[model samples]
Target: MRVPVQKQERYIAIRNVTILSVVANSLLTIVKITFGIIGNSHALIADGIHSFSSLAVDAMVLLAAKYSILPPDTRHPYGHGRYETLVTLAAGLLLIVMAIGLFSEAYEQLVGHKSPSEPTSIVLIIAFAAIIIKEAIYHYTVYIANQVNSPMLVANAWHHRSDALSSSIVVISVLGYMAGYLWVDAVATIIIASMIAYVGFEECLPAINKLIDTSINKDKRIKIKEIAESVNGVFFMHKLRTRKMGINILVDMHIVVAPRISISEAYKIAETVRHNLLDEMEEVVDVLVHIKPENTMNSLDLPQRNEITSRLQEQSIEVVEKIEKITLHYVDGKLLLDIDLPLNIIQNNNQARFISQQFADFAVNDPDIYAINTYYHGTVYDSPKVFQIDELHDFIQDKN
Candidate 1:
């Protein structure tokens, strides 16, 4: 949502600057060239070329700004801000070329040693007038660029300034010719050329950085780290990578947290980090948080399991001979119970052998006892087993 708003503002900035630059170029170019040709001033004509250079930059800025604000697509999920950088680099190349052309032409005029004619009153006034108007455009264009956070527009505005500065040089050179000093015009041309080349180099540096996916500066790093640390569960961060596509910045990083934290809590921590980043940094287009957990939670689980087992065992004891050691074991804090009882009542083999010899009635006559099996007192005795029906029958007999 915030993205749409930022993009719209940048679009407006681009449209306004392009219109201003184009209109200014059309007016200034004609005015400078008309005076330049009439006055027989080669330097003034080169200044007219500088005005034309604004048209080139205007095209670059218009394209760069409009494309930079485009929504992310499949190929460029980070949006189109890098297109702005590329166009800016292109603008830089144009500036260097224009400056070289201006210098070469100026050098030829100066060395050829022609006696230059004086400019009419109209040409001098109009050339100087162009300087004033260009300077104003520079200020306004740059002002809007900063307001909307458009780097491409900022670069274009500087292009305007370079033009204005060259025009001032033109004014000085033409005046030098009128004074018949001559060499000052060549010197000023050289300075203006150097100035353009310097600005061109400056524009190229950032474009190259963005083209190569350069890391964001320490300032942005510090901001993201601060945000990650501010969240409660996050203990640290790793794999913090950031890059720019246009105005949009992509953030991919790992966050560390305690292991015992549940899925929902970890999600909340990530959400907080993402929200704070987007809120604080309007340029950020997307955030991907990979959370890691501390390894200590597994150790704590064993002791907790033993404690639960110990508590459940307390509800599981009874007299061995009286009921085969069978007893009820309550689980779920005694809200549920498990019945355990033995199937056999006797274990001695000698008594079973004697009972088989015409003492079957004695065995059957004992109403207090039930099913018995011959085991280790005659065949090794094993632990008594639990019987399912013993609890019901024993309870009824005891009550009766």
Candidate 2:
């Protein structure tokens, strides 16, 4: 869940920046359009149209930033951050389309050598002011962008830049044309159009990069791996993927460790890594760390083996390692023993067999004795009589 914090601060920051951008663009658009009509300069009018693009971009910023912080929903479990990116990309595409249209219009004028007669002084002053003011807006937006790690804000910053560049082109073209050089205006418009293309390219490329899951670079990848592997009992990571979701990053990976470790410990390590990632880089929305165990089944087998090993090790002094099994027989007072004795000592066959039979023989022959049958697993095993015959057997006493 995306718990929305810093909402007021973020809203004020975005709202003020957006208002500033809109005011600047609107002012520039009105001023340029008025001067273009009075001065009879279509290139200046075209520049006004280019500046108009900022209105939509600013609107996008306001709308995008508002929705970006909305809490996660069932439909959007990842929150609405990507909506901001999509809007920014749309704004960039809109700019590119408008620039292309301007290029086509400028191309006709270029071929005709159409001279633009304009009253230069007012337009030049306003254009210069637009440049300074827009650049200021750009810097301010960039500051906010860095502060919040917001891609939408960054896009808005460059939108201000595009406006400044468009205004500069208008100033150059109008000033040069006022000096009676006709060709400079069209050339300037074309140059600004190319810059528009560059801006479009820059904005679109990152969106594509994000969509493609571009590596978060090799240095960071190695660092993340090192962090995960450094935790005690964690072997390594697999499928360590990192990609941007808006300005924030989405990381998913498998964190491998010994299987015997408890879930709480695994969660602790994963939590540590997640916190470190978030602390070190604020632009991470979600990190999914999958806990993987080394060998799952071997963990179950070791306990049973360890339990029997412990029992025998406690019983005898000379024994190094032994395997033993106990079975109660149908016959009354009897226990069967299956034993495998290790070869640390040089003992004769009889001695080895007797050693294997040691527990059953001792237990059975006692007055409380059950009849005992023993199997010598390490040596040859033999079937033995169930119990010894006593003198009473000759009497053939009937028994039910």
Residue-wise lDDT of candidate 2 within 30-122, one digit each (tens)? 987888777666656766877887798888888888887777789877777776778768766876886787587678778876556665577
Error of 2 at 178 (Å): 3.0
lDDT of 1 by residue, 1-400 (tens): 2364557766886798779889999888887787788867665676787788678778877777777777777986666777788888888887788778768856876788654456566666776787788888888987887887767777787778778777777677668877878777677878888988888888888888888989888999889989887888999988899987766678899898876466799999998998888888877768889877654322322324344334435433221222322222222222111222232332333333442322233224433222222211111243233323323344334433
**Model 1, stretches more than 4 Å misplaced?**
1-4, 106-118, 295-400
Model 2 residue 214 CA deviation (Å) reads 4.0
Q: Clashes in model 2: which pairs?
A: 333-370
Candidate 1 has a TM-score of 0.70
Root mean square deviation (Cα) for candidate 2: 14.1
Report per-prediction Cα RMSD to one decimal.
15.8, 14.1
